[model samples]
Target: MPVTIPEIDYEAVFQSNPSAILLLTREFDIAAANRSYERMTGAVGAEIIGRNLYEVFPGGADPKKAPGPARVRASLERVLATGRRDTVGLQRYDVELPDRPGVFEPRYWSVINAPVFDTDGRVVMILHRVMEVTAFLTQLRQAHDHGITATPAEVEAMEAEYYTRVRELQQANEQLRTAHALEREIAAALRESVERQQRFVSDASHDLRSPLTGLQTRLEFALQDASDDPQQTIRSALKDAERLTEIVADLLELARLDAATPVSTEKVDLAGFVTEELGRRVSRVPVSLDLARGVIVDASPVRLARLLGNLLANAERHAFHRIEITVAADEDTAILQVADDGPGVPAADRDQIFERFHRLDEARRSDPGGTGLGLPIAREIARAHGGRLLLTDREGGACFVLRLPRSVSTGGDSG
Candidate 1:
């Protein structure tokens, strides 16, 4: 006795298969696409069921030249004509990413084109099978380029070795992330530095050009006017030359500070230092000093004196009636503050006050003789000694606070 077997459900099998599959009619129009095909191509079965294959994947042909599409068409024609299966080893078929407008991401596939037959042995459809092998091909190419030759057993071993090195790979990936972050930070810092240098150059050029141009014009006028007073023209040119010399000197000092030139340190009493420096300045502004007894600091005396001179000069220019200097020390730090009874600095300009060649617009309008580097030089000196000079809030005046580390030993000469 012979047993009868039940008929297989071919359509159900095609729909449920894990591999991406598409069925096209004899004219190469899409007849049916499974779930896997929809996922792979970002296509819907209902939308593309009757559309031409080339219309759905326009990338099958190169847009610029017709050869790409012609080649693909020729391959399909040959498969249909011979009623045989054709294998495409590798093809790049870029697809638009879902929800990403106008972005076609790259994809690679190994594909098979086989003819499907009807009951009368006529070619009824084309069965397309696609397997994405992008990662495998990429690794294979990289291994070949690196001169790695492996047998089947060796390949298996190499795969196991790759698994073992996963932790190391993860660590390397983390290091790469850290390195990228550091690179971005460095790039930003470099850009900021470049902008600062450009601003400095522009300011310096303008300042230097003013004096030089004036001097040149004075000399040229003196040469052209025979009857003009030689002595007066000579004096005017000398004054312009003097202004240029002062600007050049300030530039040199700033350059030295930027080069991190070391200064000799000595313990000196802050009270005596401030008093002596203030007395040296010939200013009509009535000065007041509040001295803290036995307050000493380790610092370069010359640099310290220069710092005080700049601060006093600035205060003398702006102060209306009086200037006050105070020296005090805590266990760890010494504070020296200078306050004036004049209009205080604008809030917006406070942050940029210590930048090189930065001058207040009002100051430039009133006092054209300033070199614009005084506050910057003073701040650089303070920083060299591990301290800071900052503008503190004050009512009706500008107040500058200079903080420095107190000397470890208070027993030093009160020079």
Candidate 2:
């Protein structure tokens, strides 16, 4: 016969071995042990397996213990004396189950004890096949003693971090107060100083215009004979003079808008305002209207009118002969939508359209797009009235939507 060695799965063989195998001396001190024997003692097989059981579980072996080591050992001794396997009650078995995460709660179990026979057929091995109630029995702590020990030295670090944040916030608040006080002082001084120069600024540019016009005429005539290409000189001179005149006009308009306080608070009908402005501005475009009525907004009438005019004018300048103006008013808000039937604004370029000095239509760039201030001025007016004008979306051409609060907060009126 051919000789062959049996293959052994060493890991599985140890795990499924029926008993807690322990090599203990006549004095019940462990010398050599298998995996199960270490578990029954609650000691690792390598360490306590070579040590005395009495020394290892001194307090653990008290019979007074409901499921104590002595009680467990007493039952095993009965099986050894008889050389017959015997069972322990559920009370003792339930106390000794293995543990792992997310496993079930332990219930009750029956344990069997026996002795392993050696080569001489003498009982030389102790075997404890302890049953499990459920594998999850060992998860929680058995019994724990706890007391809070507080010493002042341990708390110093936490106290310092709390105080540091308090100081930082205090410093930031102090700096804000200082800056606010300085701003108020400077604003008061500016008002007083400007009062002295009020008349000079109001009339100074108009006063200079007479001399500038005369000088411009003289320069134009002098340059007429200064070069043979006199037409070029004349055109340049005209352009500069026109630019100066436009600047003066802008300054005068800005001064007026800033210097005047709001004169009256009235419920100007936005639908009527839009209708009238569209008539004046959208002459070239075919306009579709969904005009909403009874939407009274709180604002300066002149400023409001200017805002609508600019929105309508912008739509006309960019559209392909057709535009839709939709006015939606509810109890809370009024949404004015101006949609053009031209190629809509590209998604990437929509944000740039409302920026100052931005003109999306290249063909109208030569007209200077009314100084590139129409949309910005419209936004300013909308903000002053506690409303906002926004360009919503442009599919092919664009859709501009203006959202406004339905009513102004006044001192007495509830609505």
State model 1's lDDT: 0.80
Model 2 per-residue lDDT tens digits across residues 133-236: 43322222211222324334433444444445644664565467569769999999899868835744645455446547755876767767665466665666
- Model 1: per-residue Cα lDDT over 1-415, one tens digit each: 8999889999889999999998988888999999999987789999898999877776533544433344455556656877878665445566656677556666666567888888987778888888875566457445645768755566666655554464355446546756976999999999997897788778889999999999999888888989889999989989999999988888888778878988789987899898888767788689888888677889999999989989988888889999999998766788899899888899999978887777897667657789889999999999988999999999999999999988887644322
Task: Give the least accurate 10-residue stretch of model 2, judged by summed lDDT.
Answer: 136-145
Question: What is each predicted model's overall lDDT from 0 to 1?
Answer: 0.80, 0.60
The true-versus-predicted C-alpha distance at residue 147 of model 1, in Å, is: 31
TM-score of 2: 0.42
Q: Highest TM-score, which number?
A: 1
Candidate 2 total steric clashes? 6
Off by over 4 Å in 2: 1-263, 279-282, 361-366, 408-415
- In model 1, which residue pairs have backbone atoms overlapping below 3 Å? none
Model 2 whole-model lDDT (C-alpha atoms): 0.60
